[model samples]
Target: MRHSRILADVGAALRFYSRIPVPAGAAEDAFAPPNLKRIAYAVPLAGAVIGLAGAAILIGAHALGLPNLVAAILAVLTCVLLTGALHEDGLADTADGFGGGASRLRRLEIMRDSRIGSYGACALVFSLLLRVALLDGLLALSPTRAALALIAAASLSRAAGMLLLEFLPPARADGASAAAGQPGADAAVRSALVGALLATLLIVPSTGVGATLMAIGLSVLALFAMTRLSNRLIGGQTGDVAGAVQQLCEIAFLMGVLIYARPH
Candidate 1:
Protein backbone atom coordinates (compact mmCIF):
# COMPACT_ATOMS: atom_id res chain seq x y z
CA MET A 1 0.00 0.00 0.00
CA ARG A 2 1.06 3.60 -0.48
CA HIS A 3 0.86 4.22 3.26
CA SER A 4 3.16 1.34 4.02
CA ARG A 5 5.73 2.65 1.58
CA ILE A 6 5.71 6.10 3.21
CA LEU A 7 6.28 4.59 6.65
CA ALA A 8 9.05 2.44 5.26
CA ASP A 9 10.60 5.49 3.68
CA VAL A 10 10.48 7.43 6.95
CA GLY A 11 12.14 4.52 8.66
CA ALA A 12 14.75 4.48 5.94
CA ALA A 13 15.51 8.17 6.40
CA LEU A 14 15.98 7.83 10.15
CA ARG A 15 18.19 4.78 9.71
CA PHE A 16 20.41 6.49 7.17
CA TYR A 17 20.48 9.97 8.66
CA SER A 18 20.50 9.44 12.40
CA ARG A 19 21.45 7.04 15.14
CA ILE A 20 17.77 6.64 15.92
CA PRO A 21 16.56 3.06 15.82
CA VAL A 22 14.08 1.75 13.37
CA PRO A 23 11.65 -1.08 14.05
CA ALA A 24 13.89 -4.13 14.45
CA GLY A 25 12.62 -6.31 11.63
CA ALA A 26 12.19 -3.39 9.24
CA ALA A 27 15.76 -2.10 9.23
CA GLU A 28 17.01 -4.15 6.27
CA ASP A 29 13.99 -3.39 4.11
CA ALA A 30 13.98 0.32 4.92
CA PHE A 31 17.46 0.88 3.52
CA ALA A 32 17.36 -0.45 0.00
CA PRO A 33 18.89 2.78 -1.34
CA PRO A 34 16.74 2.51 -4.42
CA ASN A 35 13.64 2.58 -2.28
CA LEU A 36 15.19 5.35 -0.21
CA LYS A 37 15.75 7.48 -3.28
CA ARG A 38 12.05 7.38 -4.03
CA ILE A 39 11.23 8.92 -0.67
CA ALA A 40 14.28 11.05 -0.14
CA TYR A 41 12.09 13.94 0.96
CA ALA A 42 12.33 12.41 4.37
CA VAL A 43 15.86 13.77 4.64
CA PRO A 44 14.72 17.14 5.98
CA LEU A 45 12.15 15.52 8.22
CA ALA A 46 14.87 13.43 9.78
CA GLY A 47 17.02 16.50 10.17
CA ALA A 48 14.25 18.28 12.04
CA VAL A 49 14.15 15.43 14.52
CA ILE A 50 17.89 15.43 15.04
CA GLY A 51 18.03 19.18 15.48
CA LEU A 52 15.20 19.17 18.00
CA ALA A 53 17.03 16.59 20.07
CA GLY A 54 20.19 18.68 19.95
CA ALA A 55 18.28 21.81 20.86
CA ALA A 56 16.74 19.98 23.78
CA ILE A 57 20.21 19.04 24.95
CA LEU A 58 21.22 22.67 24.73
CA ILE A 59 18.21 23.76 26.76
CA GLY A 60 18.75 21.08 29.38
CA ALA A 61 22.43 21.87 29.70
CA HIS A 62 21.73 25.56 30.17
CA ALA A 63 19.02 24.79 32.68
CA LEU A 64 21.55 22.82 34.67
CA GLY A 65 23.73 25.95 35.11
CA LEU A 66 26.23 25.21 32.35
CA PRO A 67 28.03 28.12 30.73
CA ASN A 68 26.85 29.06 27.24
CA LEU A 69 30.05 27.67 25.72
CA VAL A 70 29.77 24.48 27.72
CA ALA A 71 26.10 24.05 26.78
CA ALA A 72 26.87 24.64 23.14
CA ILE A 73 29.65 22.08 23.20
CA LEU A 74 27.36 19.57 24.83
CA ALA A 75 24.73 20.25 22.19
CA VAL A 76 27.23 19.70 19.37
CA LEU A 77 28.52 16.57 21.02
CA THR A 78 24.97 15.29 21.31
CA CYS A 79 24.37 15.76 17.59
CA VAL A 80 27.67 14.11 16.76
CA LEU A 81 26.74 11.17 18.90
CA LEU A 82 23.15 10.97 17.68
CA THR A 83 24.02 11.05 14.01
CA GLY A 84 27.12 8.94 14.55
CA ALA A 85 29.07 11.85 13.04
CA LEU A 86 27.60 10.97 9.68
CA HIS A 87 27.90 14.35 7.96
CA GLU A 88 31.03 15.24 9.92
CA ASP A 89 32.85 12.21 8.54
CA GLY A 90 31.73 13.16 5.07
CA LEU A 91 33.09 16.66 5.65
CA ALA A 92 36.49 15.44 6.86
CA ASP A 93 36.79 13.02 3.96
CA THR A 94 35.88 15.72 1.46
CA ALA A 95 38.42 18.13 2.92
CA ASP A 96 41.14 15.50 2.73
CA GLY A 97 40.27 14.62 -0.85
CA PHE A 98 39.87 18.16 -2.06
CA GLY A 99 42.79 19.62 -0.16
CA GLY A 100 45.40 16.90 -0.24
CA GLY A 101 44.74 14.99 -3.44
CA ALA A 102 46.29 16.31 -6.64
CA SER A 103 44.23 14.65 -9.33
CA ARG A 104 40.53 14.05 -9.71
CA LEU A 105 40.88 10.30 -9.54
CA ARG A 106 43.24 10.66 -6.60
CA ARG A 107 40.73 12.87 -4.83
CA LEU A 108 38.09 10.21 -5.14
CA GLU A 109 40.59 7.66 -3.90
CA ILE A 110 41.40 9.78 -0.87
CA MET A 111 37.76 10.31 0.01
CA ARG A 112 37.13 6.58 -0.20
CA ASP A 113 40.01 5.87 2.14
CA SER A 114 38.92 4.92 5.67
CA ARG A 115 41.76 6.72 7.40
CA ILE A 116 41.70 10.39 8.25
CA GLY A 117 44.50 12.62 6.98
CA SER A 118 45.89 15.98 8.08
CA TYR A 119 43.35 17.88 6.08
CA GLY A 120 40.59 15.82 7.63
CA ALA A 121 41.89 16.54 11.09
CA CYS A 122 42.05 20.26 10.46
CA ALA A 123 38.60 20.33 8.86
CA LEU A 124 36.97 18.57 11.80
CA VAL A 125 38.72 20.81 14.28
CA PHE A 126 37.56 24.02 12.63
CA SER A 127 34.09 22.69 11.99
CA LEU A 128 33.61 21.89 15.68
CA LEU A 129 35.09 25.20 16.75
CA LEU A 130 32.95 27.21 14.35
CA ARG A 131 29.80 25.32 15.21
CA VAL A 132 30.33 25.72 18.93
CA ALA A 133 31.20 29.37 18.59
CA LEU A 134 28.12 30.11 16.55
CA LEU A 135 25.84 28.21 18.89
CA ASP A 136 27.38 29.89 21.89
CA GLY A 137 26.69 33.26 20.37
CA LEU A 138 23.11 32.33 19.64
CA LEU A 139 22.65 30.92 23.13
CA ALA A 140 23.94 34.10 24.70
CA LEU A 141 21.69 36.20 22.53
CA SER A 142 18.50 34.18 23.01
CA PRO A 143 18.07 30.51 23.70
CA THR A 144 14.67 30.37 22.01
CA ARG A 145 16.06 31.78 18.80
CA ALA A 146 18.94 29.33 19.00
CA ALA A 147 16.54 26.41 19.26
CA LEU A 148 14.57 27.54 16.24
CA ALA A 149 17.75 28.16 14.33
CA LEU A 150 18.93 24.65 15.06
CA ILE A 151 15.78 23.16 13.57
CA ALA A 152 15.79 25.45 10.54
CA ALA A 153 19.51 25.06 9.93
CA ALA A 154 19.34 21.31 10.16
CA SER A 155 16.42 21.02 7.76
CA LEU A 156 17.64 23.57 5.22
CA SER A 157 21.20 22.23 5.22
CA ARG A 158 20.03 18.79 4.17
CA ALA A 159 17.91 20.47 1.54
CA ALA A 160 21.09 22.00 0.20
CA GLY A 161 22.54 18.50 -0.08
CA MET A 162 19.41 17.44 -1.95
CA LEU A 163 20.05 20.17 -4.49
CA LEU A 164 23.54 18.88 -5.19
CA LEU A 165 22.11 15.41 -5.69
CA GLU A 166 19.61 16.90 -8.10
CA PHE A 167 22.13 18.84 -10.16
CA LEU A 168 25.24 16.64 -10.12
CA PRO A 169 25.87 13.08 -11.11
CA PRO A 170 27.90 10.90 -8.82
CA ALA A 171 31.63 11.62 -9.01
CA ARG A 172 32.40 7.96 -9.48
CA ALA A 173 30.42 5.16 -11.04
CA ASP A 174 31.01 2.69 -8.22
CA GLY A 175 30.61 5.04 -5.28
CA ALA A 176 27.94 4.81 -2.59
CA SER A 177 25.96 7.65 -4.14
CA ALA A 178 25.94 5.95 -7.52
CA ALA A 179 25.00 2.62 -6.00
CA ALA A 180 22.23 4.25 -3.96
CA GLY A 181 21.18 6.29 -7.01
CA GLN A 182 20.19 9.95 -7.14
CA PRO A 183 16.69 11.32 -6.76
CA GLY A 184 14.76 12.26 -9.85
CA ALA A 185 14.92 15.98 -10.51
CA ASP A 186 11.28 16.47 -9.67
CA ALA A 187 11.59 14.55 -6.44
CA ALA A 188 14.67 16.49 -5.44
CA VAL A 189 12.96 19.81 -6.13
CA ARG A 190 9.93 18.78 -4.14
CA SER A 191 12.11 17.79 -1.25
CA ALA A 192 13.84 21.15 -1.35
CA LEU A 193 10.53 22.96 -1.44
CA VAL A 194 9.39 21.06 1.62
CA GLY A 195 12.61 21.91 3.42
CA ALA A 196 12.44 25.57 2.47
CA LEU A 197 8.86 25.84 3.58
CA LEU A 198 9.75 24.40 6.96
CA ALA A 199 12.76 26.64 7.35
CA THR A 200 10.90 29.78 6.35
CA LEU A 201 8.11 29.07 8.77
CA LEU A 202 10.54 28.42 11.57
CA ILE A 203 12.39 31.68 11.01
CA VAL A 204 9.84 34.21 9.79
CA PRO A 205 7.70 33.95 12.90
CA SER A 206 10.54 35.04 15.17
CA THR A 207 12.94 36.94 12.94
CA GLY A 208 10.48 38.74 10.64
CA VAL A 209 10.38 38.66 6.86
CA GLY A 210 13.63 40.52 6.23
CA ALA A 211 15.78 38.30 8.39
CA THR A 212 14.12 35.17 7.07
CA LEU A 213 14.93 36.22 3.53
CA MET A 214 18.52 36.92 4.47
CA ALA A 215 18.94 33.49 6.03
CA ILE A 216 17.48 31.75 3.00
CA GLY A 217 19.61 33.82 0.62
CA LEU A 218 22.79 33.04 2.52
CA SER A 219 22.00 29.33 2.65
CA VAL A 220 21.37 29.17 -1.11
CA LEU A 221 24.54 31.04 -1.99
CA ALA A 222 26.62 28.84 0.27
CA LEU A 223 25.11 25.72 -1.25
CA PHE A 224 25.80 27.02 -4.75
CA ALA A 225 29.44 27.69 -3.99
CA MET A 226 29.91 24.29 -2.39
CA THR A 227 28.38 22.58 -5.45
CA ARG A 228 30.67 24.43 -7.84
CA LEU A 229 33.67 23.66 -5.69
CA SER A 230 32.83 19.97 -5.79
CA ASN A 231 32.35 20.08 -9.54
CA ARG A 232 35.69 21.79 -10.10
CA LEU A 233 37.58 19.40 -7.88
CA ILE A 234 36.03 16.01 -8.56
CA GLY A 235 33.83 16.56 -11.63
CA GLY A 236 30.62 16.08 -9.60
CA GLN A 237 29.10 15.03 -6.32
CA THR A 238 29.78 12.12 -3.99
CA GLY A 239 28.38 11.31 -0.60
CA ASP A 240 31.24 13.23 0.96
CA VAL A 241 30.40 16.26 -1.12
CA ALA A 242 26.81 16.10 -0.01
CA GLY A 243 27.91 15.78 3.58
CA ALA A 244 30.16 18.78 3.28
CA VAL A 245 27.30 20.74 1.84
CA GLN A 246 25.14 19.84 4.80
CA GLN A 247 27.77 20.92 7.30
CA LEU A 248 28.65 24.22 5.64
CA CYS A 249 25.11 25.07 4.78
CA GLU A 250 24.06 24.47 8.37
CA ILE A 251 26.78 26.79 9.59
CA ALA A 252 25.78 29.41 7.08
CA PHE A 253 22.16 29.17 8.11
CA LEU A 254 22.94 29.56 11.77
CA MET A 255 25.26 32.49 11.15
CA GLY A 256 22.57 34.15 9.10
CA VAL A 257 20.16 33.71 11.97
CA LEU A 258 22.63 35.08 14.47
CA ILE A 259 23.23 38.09 12.27
CA TYR A 260 19.58 38.93 11.67
CA ALA A 261 17.62 37.34 14.49
CA ARG A 262 18.48 40.03 17.05
CA PRO A 263 15.98 41.70 19.35
CA HIS A 264 13.81 44.12 17.46
Candidate 2:
Protein backbone atom coordinates (compact mmCIF):
# COMPACT_ATOMS: atom_id res chain seq x y z
CA MET A 1 0.00 0.00 0.00
CA ARG A 2 2.84 2.38 0.79
CA HIS A 3 4.54 1.61 -2.49
CA SER A 4 1.31 2.17 -4.35
CA ARG A 5 0.89 5.50 -2.65
CA ILE A 6 4.36 6.57 -3.75
CA LEU A 7 3.58 5.69 -7.34
CA ALA A 8 0.36 7.59 -7.14
CA ASP A 9 2.21 10.63 -5.82
CA VAL A 10 4.65 10.38 -8.73
CA GLY A 11 1.74 10.29 -11.15
CA ALA A 12 0.23 13.33 -9.51
CA ALA A 13 3.47 15.31 -9.74
CA LEU A 14 3.88 14.41 -13.39
CA ARG A 15 0.32 15.43 -14.11
CA PHE A 16 0.79 18.75 -12.30
CA TYR A 17 3.61 19.79 -14.60
CA SER A 18 2.77 18.03 -17.81
CA ARG A 19 -0.02 18.83 -20.24
CA ILE A 20 -2.20 16.20 -18.58
CA PRO A 21 -5.00 17.17 -16.27
CA VAL A 22 -5.01 16.22 -12.62
CA PRO A 23 -8.11 14.39 -11.47
CA ALA A 24 -10.05 15.57 -8.43
CA GLY A 25 -8.81 14.30 -5.03
CA ALA A 26 -5.29 13.70 -6.29
CA ALA A 27 -4.12 16.80 -4.49
CA GLU A 28 -5.15 15.26 -1.18
CA ASP A 29 -2.50 12.59 -1.43
CA ALA A 30 0.69 13.37 0.44
CA PHE A 31 3.71 13.88 -1.83
CA ALA A 32 5.91 10.82 -1.43
CA PRO A 33 9.71 10.75 -1.66
CA PRO A 34 9.65 8.77 -4.87
CA ASN A 35 7.14 11.19 -6.31
CA LEU A 36 9.40 14.13 -5.51
CA LYS A 37 12.22 12.37 -7.32
CA ARG A 38 9.97 11.77 -10.26
CA ILE A 39 9.01 15.43 -10.47
CA ALA A 40 12.64 16.56 -10.19
CA TYR A 41 13.74 14.12 -12.86
CA ALA A 42 10.80 14.65 -15.16
CA VAL A 43 11.50 18.37 -15.65
CA PRO A 44 14.70 18.00 -17.68
CA LEU A 45 13.38 14.96 -19.49
CA ALA A 46 10.39 16.93 -20.71
CA GLY A 47 12.66 19.77 -21.85
CA ALA A 48 14.81 17.32 -23.79
CA VAL A 49 11.74 15.87 -25.46
CA ILE A 50 10.53 19.32 -26.45
CA GLY A 51 13.95 20.22 -27.80
CA LEU A 52 14.02 17.07 -29.89
CA ALA A 53 10.58 17.80 -31.25
CA GLY A 54 11.63 21.32 -32.22
CA ALA A 55 14.68 19.91 -33.96
CA ALA A 56 12.57 17.45 -35.92
CA ILE A 57 10.30 20.21 -37.11
CA LEU A 58 13.26 22.36 -38.15
CA ILE A 59 14.93 19.48 -39.98
CA GLY A 60 11.74 18.56 -41.82
CA ALA A 61 11.20 22.15 -42.79
CA HIS A 62 14.73 22.47 -44.14
CA ALA A 63 14.48 19.22 -46.10
CA LEU A 64 11.28 20.43 -47.73
CA GLY A 65 12.79 23.87 -48.42
CA LEU A 66 10.26 25.52 -46.15
CA PRO A 67 10.82 29.20 -45.46
CA ASN A 68 12.84 30.11 -42.34
CA LEU A 69 9.97 32.27 -41.16
CA VAL A 70 7.61 29.34 -41.26
CA ALA A 71 10.13 27.06 -39.55
CA ALA A 72 10.63 29.59 -36.76
CA ILE A 73 6.93 29.93 -36.16
CA LEU A 74 6.52 26.18 -35.95
CA ALA A 75 9.40 25.86 -33.50
CA VAL A 76 7.81 28.44 -31.21
CA LEU A 77 4.52 26.61 -31.39
CA THR A 78 6.26 23.36 -30.49
CA CYS A 79 7.81 24.94 -27.38
CA VAL A 80 4.49 26.42 -26.35
CA LEU A 81 2.72 23.13 -26.68
CA LEU A 82 5.34 21.07 -24.89
CA THR A 83 5.70 23.31 -21.83
CA GLY A 84 2.02 24.25 -21.82
CA ALA A 85 3.07 27.91 -21.79
CA LEU A 86 4.08 27.74 -18.13
CA HIS A 87 7.36 29.57 -18.55
CA GLU A 88 5.73 32.30 -20.59
CA ASP A 89 3.37 32.94 -17.72
CA GLY A 90 6.31 33.14 -15.39
CA LEU A 91 8.08 35.60 -17.64
CA ALA A 92 5.03 37.77 -17.88
CA ASP A 93 4.43 37.74 -14.14
CA THR A 94 8.04 38.59 -13.44
CA ALA A 95 7.92 41.45 -15.89
CA ASP A 96 4.79 42.81 -14.26
CA GLY A 97 6.28 42.51 -10.78
CA PHE A 98 9.56 44.17 -11.60
CA GLY A 99 8.26 46.84 -13.93
CA GLY A 100 5.21 48.19 -12.12
CA GLY A 101 5.20 47.08 -8.50
CA ALA A 102 6.82 49.34 -5.92
CA SER A 103 7.21 46.96 -3.00
CA ARG A 104 7.79 43.26 -2.43
CA LEU A 105 4.20 42.67 -1.40
CA ARG A 106 2.91 44.75 -4.27
CA ARG A 107 5.09 42.85 -6.71
CA LEU A 108 3.73 39.59 -5.43
CA GLU A 109 0.21 40.88 -5.73
CA ILE A 110 0.75 42.11 -9.29
CA MET A 111 2.27 38.80 -10.31
CA ARG A 112 -0.76 36.95 -9.03
CA ASP A 113 -3.05 38.93 -11.27
CA SER A 114 -3.98 37.03 -14.44
CA ARG A 115 -4.41 40.03 -16.65
CA ILE A 116 -1.37 41.04 -18.70
CA GLY A 117 0.26 44.39 -18.07
CA SER A 118 2.27 46.63 -20.39
CA TYR A 119 5.54 45.31 -19.04
CA GLY A 120 4.42 41.75 -19.63
CA ALA A 121 3.31 42.64 -23.16
CA CYS A 122 6.66 44.18 -24.02
CA ALA A 123 8.60 41.36 -22.41
CA LEU A 124 6.68 38.75 -24.37
CA VAL A 125 7.23 40.56 -27.63
CA PHE A 126 10.97 40.89 -27.09
CA SER A 127 11.39 37.35 -25.83
CA LEU A 128 9.50 35.84 -28.77
CA LEU A 129 11.31 38.04 -31.29
CA LEU A 130 14.73 37.11 -29.88
CA ARG A 131 13.90 33.43 -29.67
CA VAL A 132 12.67 33.30 -33.24
CA ALA A 133 15.68 35.23 -34.54
CA LEU A 134 18.17 33.02 -32.71
CA LEU A 135 16.41 29.83 -33.76
CA ASP A 136 16.27 30.94 -37.38
CA GLY A 137 19.99 31.62 -37.36
CA LEU A 138 20.67 28.23 -35.80
CA LEU A 139 18.52 26.49 -38.41
CA ALA A 140 20.44 28.29 -41.13
CA LEU A 141 23.67 26.82 -39.79
CA SER A 142 22.50 23.16 -39.88
CA PRO A 143 19.43 21.26 -38.83
CA THR A 144 21.51 19.06 -36.55
CA ARG A 145 23.07 22.05 -34.82
CA ALA A 146 19.69 23.69 -34.46
CA ALA A 147 18.32 20.57 -32.83
CA LEU A 148 21.23 20.27 -30.43
CA ALA A 149 21.03 23.92 -29.51
CA LEU A 150 17.36 23.69 -28.71
CA ILE A 151 17.86 20.57 -26.66
CA ALA A 152 20.74 22.04 -24.71
CA ALA A 153 19.04 25.36 -24.14
CA ALA A 154 15.83 23.77 -22.99
CA SER A 155 17.50 21.34 -20.62
CA LEU A 156 20.05 23.76 -19.20
CA SER A 157 17.53 26.52 -18.67
CA ARG A 158 15.31 24.27 -16.58
CA ALA A 159 18.31 22.95 -14.71
CA ALA A 160 19.28 26.49 -13.94
CA GLY A 161 15.82 27.06 -12.54
CA MET A 162 16.19 24.02 -10.34
CA LEU A 163 19.49 25.30 -9.06
CA LEU A 164 17.87 28.57 -8.05
CA LEU A 165 15.15 26.68 -6.27
CA GLU A 166 17.67 24.65 -4.35
CA PHE A 167 19.74 27.64 -3.25
CA LEU A 168 17.14 30.35 -2.70
CA PRO A 169 14.29 30.68 -0.23
CA PRO A 170 10.78 30.81 -1.55
CA ALA A 171 9.14 34.21 -1.52
CA ARG A 172 5.58 33.05 -1.04
CA ALA A 173 4.16 30.59 1.43
CA ASP A 174 2.03 29.04 -1.28
CA GLY A 175 3.35 28.65 -4.81
CA ALA A 176 5.23 26.31 -7.12
CA SER A 177 8.63 27.10 -5.65
CA ALA A 178 7.39 26.29 -2.16
CA ALA A 179 5.94 23.04 -3.40
CA ALA A 180 9.22 22.11 -5.10
CA GLY A 181 11.11 22.86 -1.91
CA GLN A 182 10.02 19.52 -0.55
CA PRO A 183 12.68 17.68 -2.56
CA GLY A 184 15.73 16.46 -0.65
CA ALA A 185 19.11 18.09 -1.25
CA ASP A 186 20.69 14.93 -2.61
CA ALA A 187 17.95 14.48 -5.16
CA ALA A 188 18.16 18.08 -6.22
CA VAL A 189 21.92 17.81 -6.62
CA ARG A 190 21.61 14.72 -8.76
CA SER A 191 18.99 16.35 -10.93
CA ALA A 192 21.17 19.44 -11.38
CA LEU A 193 24.19 17.37 -12.37
CA VAL A 194 22.20 15.39 -14.90
CA GLY A 195 20.80 18.54 -16.44
CA ALA A 196 24.23 20.16 -16.65
CA LEU A 197 25.74 17.05 -18.26
CA LEU A 198 22.99 16.90 -20.86
CA ALA A 199 23.41 20.59 -21.65
CA THR A 200 27.18 20.20 -21.97
CA LEU A 201 26.81 17.31 -24.38
CA LEU A 202 24.57 19.38 -26.62
CA ILE A 203 26.70 22.52 -26.68
CA VAL A 204 30.34 21.33 -26.56
CA PRO A 205 30.41 19.08 -29.63
CA SER A 206 28.80 21.42 -32.16
CA THR A 207 29.93 24.75 -30.72
CA GLY A 208 33.71 24.07 -30.71
CA VAL A 209 36.19 25.85 -28.45
CA GLY A 210 35.33 29.53 -28.98
CA ALA A 211 31.60 29.09 -28.93
CA THR A 212 31.76 26.82 -25.90
CA LEU A 213 33.90 29.33 -24.05
CA MET A 214 31.50 32.12 -24.96
CA ALA A 215 28.57 30.10 -23.80
CA ILE A 216 30.25 29.42 -20.46
CA GLY A 217 31.07 33.09 -20.02
CA LEU A 218 27.56 34.15 -20.87
CA SER A 219 26.07 31.53 -18.58
CA VAL A 220 28.13 32.84 -15.68
CA LEU A 221 27.05 36.39 -16.40
CA ALA A 222 23.43 35.32 -16.48
CA LEU A 223 23.70 33.43 -13.22
CA PHE A 224 25.24 36.39 -11.44
CA ALA A 225 22.59 38.77 -12.69
CA MET A 226 19.82 36.38 -11.78
CA THR A 227 21.19 35.85 -8.30
CA ARG A 228 21.24 39.57 -7.72
CA LEU A 229 17.77 40.01 -9.13
CA SER A 230 16.42 37.22 -6.96
CA ASN A 231 17.96 38.73 -3.89
CA ARG A 232 16.45 42.13 -4.60
CA LEU A 233 12.95 40.98 -5.42
CA ILE A 234 10.88 39.55 -2.55
CA GLY A 235 14.08 38.85 -0.59
CA GLY A 236 14.74 35.59 -2.44
CA GLN A 237 13.75 33.54 -5.47
CA THR A 238 10.21 32.56 -6.40
CA GLY A 239 8.96 30.22 -9.09
CA ASP A 240 8.64 33.18 -11.40
CA VAL A 241 12.28 34.10 -10.75
CA ALA A 242 13.31 30.62 -11.75
CA GLY A 243 11.43 30.95 -15.02
CA ALA A 244 12.96 34.36 -15.63
CA VAL A 245 16.41 32.88 -15.12
CA GLN A 246 15.73 30.21 -17.70
CA GLN A 247 14.48 32.74 -20.20
CA LEU A 248 17.47 34.99 -19.62
CA CYS A 249 19.88 32.07 -19.93
CA GLU A 250 18.32 31.07 -23.23
CA ILE A 251 18.89 34.56 -24.56
CA ALA A 252 22.41 34.60 -23.18
CA PHE A 253 23.29 31.29 -24.84
CA LEU A 254 21.95 32.51 -28.15
CA MET A 255 23.92 35.71 -27.84
CA GLY A 256 27.04 33.70 -27.13
CA VAL A 257 26.45 31.57 -30.20
CA LEU A 258 25.94 34.65 -32.35
CA ILE A 259 29.05 36.35 -31.04
CA TYR A 260 31.17 33.29 -31.68
CA ALA A 261 29.75 32.96 -35.19
CA ARG A 262 30.62 36.54 -36.03
CA PRO A 263 33.34 37.05 -38.68
CA HIS A 264 36.65 38.57 -37.72
The lDDT leader among the candidates is: 1
Query: What are the candidates' C-alpha RMSDs?
Result: 1.9, 4.4
lDDT score, candidate 1 = 0.85
Stretches of candidate 1 exceeding 4 Å from the true structure: 1-7, 24-28, 34-36
User: Which portions of model 2 miss their true places by more than 4 Å?
Assistant: 1-16, 20-42, 182-185, 261-264
Worst 10 residues of 2 by lDDT: 29-38
lDDT of 2 by residue, 1-264 (tens): 276554454455435544544442445553432244555655565566667777788778778889876787788777767667777888888899988999999999898898999999888888888888887887777667667777777766666676677667788888777766645566567656766677677777776667756865686588678878767977777778777877777777766765665322
Q: lDDT tens string, model 1, 1-264?
A: 387766666667778778798773434664455443576687887788888898999999988999999999998898889899999999999999999999999999999998999999998999889889999998887888788888888888887888898788899998778877888888788778878898889988877777677778888998899889999999999988899899998888888888886764
Each candidate structure's TM-score, on Cα atoms with residue i matched to residue i, is: 0.94, 0.83
How does candidate 1 fare on TM-score?
0.94
Cα lDDT listed for each candidate: 0.85, 0.71
